[model samples]
Target: MKILPYHPSVLAQAQLVDLINYCQNTEAHLAIKMAEQADIFAIPQVYQQSGGNFWIAQDAQQIVGCIALLPLDAHTGVLKKFFTYPPYRGQPVRLGAQLFDQLLNFAQQHDFTRLVLDTPAAETRSHTFYEHHGFRRITPNELAVAYSYPDRHSWLYELQL
Candidate 1:
């Protein structure tokens, strides 16, 4: 699969709608306690800002997965809204790893050194994904305003590039 930054006009309306639906389906059922972390609307807004660049995995010209990066500062960025379509979901962890690699490459080229992200405690798979990618979990009582979600405890991860 070819992964590249998202361009507003490159993705169709149907795909954006699907992404919204996917966001709702994925985060909607979290317990109220977990809902806060799941309710990050700025995820889509990142697409609008295009500040840190969003990446999509395309095959045969079809978008099968995507991830977005939002810079918190010149040296740190939050990786958010990552998803691979159901039909394309499976072990090819390479897909995500590669996207991350690209993100880091971009960061380095731009003089950044830290990549950060938050994952809900309930998502074991995501935890594993980050661990496998060489990210370390941070233990802190308070979270950054952007990382804090109401219902769930957010797990913070940091990768040094």
Candidate 2:
């Protein structure tokens, strides 16, 4: 797989729409959130000012994965939208590790010292992925303002870079 710079709105939407469709197949929530939209809109601004970077991964010619970096503070940041296609999920942790490494390298180059992210409370796969990369679980919080939805609360995670 090859990773390249990509604007989140370019292919991330299709991936997310695919996730929404997949969720629908399992009777899950399908509402889009402002947080996601804000992230999408901020990618360019972040890139311009050194606060964020977005990447796309491809297999052959298809976009199979994506990740984004967003600053949480001058010395800290957040990693968001890290995803890979379902068919490629069985690969070694290297994929996520590499993507995360890239983000961390960026943070290091920018003087960031920590990073934070949130994942769904029940997404065991994601929890494991984050844990394998040295993230620790923090107290779970109801992100009613960021998520703004009663049923889609998330557990927060953090990684020191």
User: All candidates' lDDT scores?
Assistant: 0.65, 0.65
Flag clash pairs in model 1: 33-151, 34-151, 34-152, 36-149, 36-150, 36-151, 37-149
Model 1's TM-score against the true structure = 0.72
lDDT for position 144 in model 2: 17
Alpha-carbon runs more than 4 Å astray in model 1? 10-13, 23-51, 86-93, 141-151
Task: Tell me how far the alpha carbon of residue 4 in candidate 1 is from the true structure, in angstroms, after superposition.
Answer: 2.1
lDDT of 1: 0.65
Q: Where in model 2 is the C-alpha error above 4 Å?
A: 7-38, 46-50, 92-94, 140-151
Q: Per-residue lDDT tens digits of candidate 2, residues 118-152?
A: 76676778889888879887753621123221334
